[model samples]
Target: MAAVKLPTQRLYGTSFTCQISERNKDPPVGDEVWGTLVKEFSDVPDASAITRITVRLVIAAVLGGVLGFERESKGRSAGLRTHMLVAVGAALFVLGPLQSGMQIGDLSRVLQGVVQGIGFLGAGAIIIRSAQREVEGLTTAASIWATAAIGVMAGLGMEVTAVLSTAIVLVILAAVPHILPTPSETDSKSIGDD
Candidate 1:
């Protein structure tokens, strides 16, 4: 039986979705899991053609680098090198078992493992300034997750979708927040009435 490809299904059905992590025993934040799940598909690209390991690495690195460029431009912690490695490493990981024809417990487990692993990298991108009660880097971490997905898109030969998605992601990350009104502004009148 074939493994479920979460992002492909989710993307087609809904703009957003969520999943629970059995290991963590909690519902993971939807956006983060969605991004990582996309990255995990770096295994075979499509089932039709076998990919060369070297080519996979190049695609992962280059695709990751391009997405990472946008993150680095914003001075994110998980910039070029980190993004590049995550993608290339994921490609290598999925390729290993499949190329060898090893009977693994559904490909989805491999993908789940990828998500569990990337969580460590994502955690590092977040920073808490206890003194000032300020937190940062969540979006940067999300971007890293997204960069990995781009690599999978490249690995799978979905080049146009990958490129278009990357552009859309960049615009949303860079511009959307700036145009939206802050929650504080919307709630100010409520407080004044008290």
Candidate 2:
């Protein structure tokens, strides 16, 4: 007999099963097409998913925008769009596995990945001037890190928590500065920029 072909194989020491099938790659027709495109967004059908996806994403964006407004008012490089994108991106990272039915325990990996990825982005905001012995963007970097955490909270459906946290962050970014003592004339030049 001719050699039989198996639908499964072991690759990279992991055995996997594979199925060959054809799917309709073409777009759907009529009313079905509309639902097919937006079922996940419809109020009646996918209400829960809508809450998870749309509500969370919007909350993330608004909160991020608030943070961005503060940074932008101060003429920081990482402003509104940057912060909003970071918040929304962080929320999506959590939302994807959540919509896929992954257990809460499995989400730790996703959270870790988001934090590490945001760290790289925050690092970009930092500026170290060795000759001038000045460190800049610390506050901006910290804000990005905190914004990601807030996004994660929003994505987890903690809307109230997200709002409260946003309020607290706004206070830290805005009120705390005015309340703090000003830098001395000698310290002004070397003071870290936001």
* Winning model by TM-score: 2
Clashes of each: 1, 0
lDDT of each residue in 16-39, candidate 2, tens digit only: 876433344335577677877687
Cα misplacement distance, residue 193 of candidate 2 (Å): 5.4
TM-score of each: 0.59, 0.75
The candidate scoring highest on lDDT is: 2
lDDT of 1 by residue, 51-149 (tens): 455666687787777767777887777788888888877766666656657565665677678777877788788887666555678777777777766
Any idea what lDDT model 2 has?
Answer: 0.86
RMSD score of candidate 2 (Å): 13.6
Off by over 4 Å in 1: 1-52, 102-105, 181-194
Worst 10 residues of 1 by lDDT: 185-194
Residue 96 of model 1 has an lDDT of 68
